[model samples]
Target: METKKLLKAAAGAMIVAFAISACQTKKTATGQNADPAHNSMNSVDWAGTYQGTLPCADCPGIRYTITLKDDDTYVLKTRYLEKGDSVFTESGTFAWDENGGKITLADRGEKFQVGENKLFHLDMEGNRITGSLAEHYVLTKMTDQITDRYWKLIEVGGQAVADGSTQKEPYIQLNSEGNRVEATGGCNGMGGTYELKEPNRISFSQLIGTLMACENMEVENGLKRALESADSYHVQGDTLQLFRARMAPLAKFVAKGK
Candidate 1:
């Protein structure tokens, strides 16, 4: 009888050990299947400025611009079109959701779903907005370089561009497609091709413009001269400076609606 009892105890111990080993094996398999590498926080190049016009019931629309930094901070600017020129600015930290696909603004509890070169505005419940207006909630990421933006001419020949000096605001847009450039010196429209060589070296060619004369051709003439002589360029934040050799900046521009 004693021998039988000892045999039974040994068999029971073996069964428990086998059960524990099987559990561990199952756990290891489950862990291997969990993919943490494909999330937006790790996979997406999400840092940059994103801009869009969000819908508003009482106003025309809200120009929303949000800049996300790699350090998990954000700057939000909003302007109600046709309301006033005042731009509301907000700055604060943001935290990603547990799934790493969504971020919440710490100050206002606003949420946005992070995606490739875009952000989807989420509702209060942290869910994507649905229906016809859904597409309007998307914000496109802006390039960090001096391309595909409206650069308003603020200074030319070391002088500030006065308000109402020209019929329209002086601005330039560098289109990435075919490296084309379009500008208005607050009067006649101008078009040209621009080449960006090396890091900051730049040149404009095939410049053409409308012959219509305006009351104030000073800004327009200066702009053309600056473009012809600019050999290098510098972009700091929203400001762009054109340089001729090592001399002072020939002209300065600020990114519009930045």
Candidate 2:
């Protein structure tokens, strides 16, 4: 009877040891105690165009347009309004911070915290700005499409292009089919080929327009000049702005009907 009791106790001990070992193996395989990592780089849909007007001391404001791509590259453009017609543009790869919450521009050393549909500008030390001006440092994402729509010229070189000033309101249409661009500069019909080299970079070529001249050719002349000089563009909601380098927009347009 004593031998049988000892045998039973030994079997029980073996079963308990096997069960504890299996439990530990399961925990290790499933990673039950590990914490999952989450950050803006993995959680946010951050690759897109962002734009805002930052405060400036000597000028009205600094217009900023930045484009971040999925390939870890970026394009940054800035214009100091009321200062001069010069747009500063920079492009290069960007690096994510250790925690993957922020990005530092490779060329400018500028840092921005990635957020949902926006970016928060950080100071040189990588801290968010404080006080009343903090709100002005945000850059909102732009999701509007720039092609296959009628863009009516609203302002040209800081001057408003009034409706009915010409036979046909000045407008441009970018067709995605053949990369063709068709326009009417308030009076004459114009056709050209346009190429979008990068996210915001654009160039117009093979431009040919009607030879007829109107009495007031101011709008037409300005529109043509804007098209020829524009090397970059910005789209915010229904508005489209064409720019050269980092200067102010040479021309601004609004989408008409859908």
User: Which candidate leads in TM-score?
Assistant: 1
Candidate 2 C-alpha lDDT tens digits along 1-258: 999999999999999999999998888555453233657888889987898999999888999888888999887878898877677777789999877788999968999999999999999999889999999999998778676679999999989988888877899998654668999888899999887744788889889999887866899999999999999999888999999996988999999973
TM-score per candidate: 0.50, 0.49
TM-score of 1: 0.50
lDDT tens digits by residue: candidate 1, 55-113: 99999999887888899988787888889767787888999987678999997999999
lDDT of each candidate versus the true structure: 0.87, 0.87
CA RMSD of all predictions: 14.4, 12.1
Q: Report the lDDT of model 2 for residue 247.
A: 99
Sliding window of 10 residues with minimal summed lDDT for model 1: 27-36
